[model samples]
Target chain A: MSSRRDILDLLGENARYTTEDLAHMTDFTESEVEEVVAELEDAGVITGYQAVINWDALETDAERVRATVELNVALDRETNYGDIADRIAKFPEVTSLRLVSGDYDFDLTVEGDSMREVSHFISDKVAPIPEITQTVTHYIMESYKEQGTEFDDHDDDDRLSVSP
Target chain B: MTLEPADRVDAVPPSGIRRFFELAEEMDDIISLGVGEPDFSAPWAAREAAITSLERGQTSYTANKGKRELRTRISRFEDAARDLRYDPDEEILVTAGASEGLDLAFRALLNSGDKLAVAQPCYVSYVPGATFAGVDVVDVPTRAEDEFKLTREVLEASGAAEADALVYCYPNNPTGATMTGDELREVAAFCREHDLVVFSDEIYADLTYEHEHISIATLPGMRERTVVFNGFSKAFAMTGFRLGYAMGPEEAITAMNRVHQYTMLSAPTTAQHAAIEALDNCQADVREMTAQYDRRRNYVLSRFEDMGLSCFPASGAFYAFPECPWDDADEFAEAFLQEQKVAVVPGSAFGAGGDGHLRISYATGLDELKTAMNRLESFIS
Candidate 1:
């Protein structure tokens, strides 16, 4: 079976379970969950761990703003993708990081309380590195759907299953 | 054809402007106001400058941002008109036109699925441009009572109050509405507060009837948030010349410059030289054109009123947007052409709120306009 079926079988049974719960439910140990998670991460199948928060219950005064940050970087031989990824991945507030096609090198999803906090994080923290050259940031005013977690289940075998 | 997996074609749509042009071409001798290109030619002096550059044999590609001379001229032009100061070397960039500048701005700034806010009944370019950049466009529809001016209330109501960027156009196309200096300052303040990057298209800055064009970038704390798009097309009558520029934070310009270099290399060599002359020697030409347009604007409005159609006096730009006497603007526009041989674009061609109106370009000769009005009167009656 494909790794997707294995992962789907896991999530399909219980989606809200913790990593430990998932290990227990699957009759595997917690160390096995860690191993599978690592394997999935390496295979580019399981992309992220999201904190699904109820905004109304979490913080009444919170004003969450989504901003798109375009970073212009100048990396040295020593400062490769791994180093740069490691540097940016440290910020818990950065929800997503993508290597895009075109003028900008990286596009970042930054969350903050206000515009000032967002700008400060980008200008002061993200842009000050020697490997970093420049940055252009834009705050999201509204979201039709804020990057929904919909796993596209494409069954390659199902198409061929009908074919001879 | 289906068997060849390698022969699959990209399913992209044609450019809005090109599609409009193609539609306009179908009708013979159609006096089209559909395409938003200036009817005037480049000034003699501006044309002379391009000739001079050709004589100097500058055919090779220029710096990605632009030639220092052209950027310097643009800097002076913005400073004189809107009191916004930009560093020619660091902040200003030349592109094929305002269209290309917009394209670069979005590609450099937007990621996939990023939402950008736009005012409705705007230039048709914004929607398609945002679509091409893999971003969603959230339109903030301006009311007729607001004179289609982009206001704080409009921004607030858009549900897009936090859009990644706001594309603003003033002395607007189709609707000839303009924003005052004070209004721009308020918008700038709002943008700063919301962390919205303002893509201000001030292409029609020179064509305002009663007031001066205000640059949002001039407002306090706005230099960092605003990327302005301007060109020689509308004001300097160099639409065919295809020269435009963007000015903003050095970081954005640097990113935008790379896109310009790769995609277009530079604006036409001749157009850039001509643009410099346009900045220098064409002030009188602009005044002359503005005066003629004002006369035509008033004439068209009066003619529409005389024919019992309601028309709000346009404050800027050369087009007169009059409410169609009939129910459907598209039907009226098509039938008028068939019966009276008068060509005007249905306002619906622009966007949603434009359904009941018709956009008539007064860029034609006065005699032709008079004949068109007479024909229109007879057809309607």
Candidate 2:
């Protein structure tokens, strides 16, 4: 049997490669490729495919502001921070949420249309949670790299056209 | 006035591997499994470091031995990983690439007619490089049964006793064969007994699949007599950066440095900076790339088996040399490329005893590799 993880790894790099292409790469027949992909989609292993865009490079009227908010949470015997974390995660504005070590209990990244929108997300939505004792927000200024990909194109690939 | 090329230049034959590359250059819809370079770009952090160095105006020739910081990083990296302690200041000399390091080692160690023992079905450079330096190369044909390893018996049988030095490449190019630590120790013992200098080309050290790469220099009493050549090309996907280094005795390093200084002033300053960054950070990236190579290697091996071709499973590097169905590998390679639009190297290009084999590189993207395999199946059938 061919590895399902290998298919996922290739898709993670470039989802645009066709099933036929994936078949060739993974040594799976085209039908087998389709079957494995369908299974992965049904199992929720592959939720969706989306483009990785550089928003800063585009000239647009509306721009998104992103920030990481650290929360000091108080936990009780039952439910604990799970209930509150689930509540925060349910918000469409929350991009990622995680339970972190040290002074903060939950570290979250939230994105909004503007700086005002992000501040409003903290004051109106996040701060209102009773279990959250305190919150600290840090806005992302610039990104040199994200998701294991470098944004800069300064040094191009320099391998010979053909070499052995 | 007409000028004549040097007699040595005329004596050396043109590389057989270059013919297919030249043919592919003229053809459209050609898929090449010939090139040994990684299809992936250099890690972003490494590229970014070069850019940052340029922005900071750090463009000039570096110290003849390379920047001190980079040397120290190489020393530390070797020491931590392989227990090889090379004083960066005295025993290491940065080179343009492992190619240059190999050339320099040959030039420094060999005088006219000095005999050098080399394993066959290896990288294409060793024989020609030795010949260019006026050294007579003694061929030791490693068989497929031995998994292409250089054993003491092979050396003794090949008249290595008369040779002044020996050169070996593990995770060997073309064959993709690698020697284990114990296996290498026996070879090291033989070298000691013969008092022959050893040149170890470890360009593919980081590309090993199943086991950790064991440098011969790390063996007992061999460090002083061995010159280890490694580079950023295969490992970091930094072939264009042209950065490599040699570690050995102070005297040998000094001699290599003397040749390097005269031929090449220094490796690019920007590449040196990027190499430092690659060593300091980018372990995760290296692991990611290596994982991809392993996946491809396994896929190729299984495909070869399914096709009923006899292939020695490669435990290192990104190449697989499988016995071709035909008797003459050169004819098979040329015909396959011409008819199927897929390119592979004839095993004979490497050296003696490589006939009836084809060298396939899995360094291309997975999709391309798969396509190449399908075309190969059609060609064979």
Candidate 3:
């Protein structure tokens, strides 16, 4: 049976426990935690790990701005696009990246203090990529909810309509 | 009886909120702001009405339209509270909740491939509901500068005015924004011109602190084009009870009733009895609760503002939409939990206009609200 510890890490907070800490939390042996982690990694589920930094740590002065860059790419250029995304994803400003359907191919979430910060990243970093053809940026004007894998309650029937 | 996959199949996904809540339950010291349910209990009179009905052997199924007393009470409540008049026998049909009324409206009025002009920063259910009814939804984003309230200008700008329908929800859930009389008048006029059916959700009507809630059905000629949806959930603090009703023109009501009769048959008889009392006797209770929500709403708005998070003052309902410190609102909300131990929903759950904002629900106790505020400050600062 799959460990309950592994389920919690996937569905809830991924950072809630270290391998050893999860072993303790779930009252399992350390080997059990290690085994679960290994299985998850082999399955390509536990892809990567990083620290979640506090927003206050990033800014010295001025307000914060967020923008979503919608990219359109063809299927034929998948390998080249992956290489481009890998390089762009290395930027300190980029937070999340997802391949989406509809009008855009890849949705890149970026944050900075001003529109210039976002524009500079797009022009300096993203636009230089070879496989990218079109891009549309949506500056987030307001938010109602945003919890990465935490509080999102998306139903399968979620509909998307373009804003003209 | 043998059933085909199409006949027996279910389409809507199971609610993720409840599943997440169950997961969070295993973690100790987790304070949840996940539920959209009210924290308050149903009033004693409403409870007593249910008990009385059981004692009087009123457990049998009611008429498909609902109990006559409940229907009459619903009509009076609409006329007295929202200035909308309807014939109890022809124009009012009790539903399981506003959810059911919303579903009935979509199922009855919408043809396949019809486009519904939906305001963004709307309740999560509206999109899914439209989809299940086989209609396409076109989102019209209500601006942050305008407090996320829907206006005729926003609707007109969508260029889908010629579409089949409009799904309206004010005293709205996620944003807590509402439409005023002037706005409703313009919407009514526009709908009349386009012959669009308006599904107006007034579930939070009595909870509005800024202005008296107005019904689009009350507008001249709007009764024919508007389906007014309301329930006991918000106003009477009866979310678990699940009693709601819809009012509209006789023809529309009849069509919706046909769907309701087959799908639901009738709402809970005990709930219907209790709902009648809620309509008749719970006005004062609603006022007191609304005042409490107003206090919490004001408190949360000020808290967010002081923390340098840009927030819009919520005009109705019990939520505060505060800007998060990250570009991805989801990342911000999750980081907040890791740092502050406070849980707030990421704005992206409501659709496009919600990025960079998080919704904080102030539906718990004053002390819990204060603790959440302090945790939020500690995290943000």
Using TM-score, give the best candidate's number: 2
Q: Is the docking of candidate 3 incorrect, acceptable, medium or high quality?
A: incorrect
Tens-place lDDT digits, model 2, residues B269-313: 999999999999977888898888887887788778778889998
Candidate 1: docking tier: incorrect
Off by over 4 Å in 1: A1-164, B1-24
Model 2, residue A67: C-alpha shift (Å): 12
Model 3 lDDT, residue B278, Cα: 88
Each model's DockQ? 0.00, 0.24, 0.01
Deviation in Å, model 3, residue B311 alpha carbon:
1.0
Worst 10 residues of 3 chain B by lDDT: B15-24
Model 3, stretches more than 4 Å misplaced?
A1-164, B1-23
lDDT of 2 by residue, A1-164 (tens): 45998899889998997886677556688899899999999999999998876677778887879999999988777757789889999999998999988988999999999999999999999999888899999999987777756687565434443576
Interface RMSD list for the candidates:
29.9, 3.8, 15.8
DockQ of 1: 0.00
Question: Which run of 10 residues does model 1 chain B get worst, by summed lDDT?
Answer: B4-13
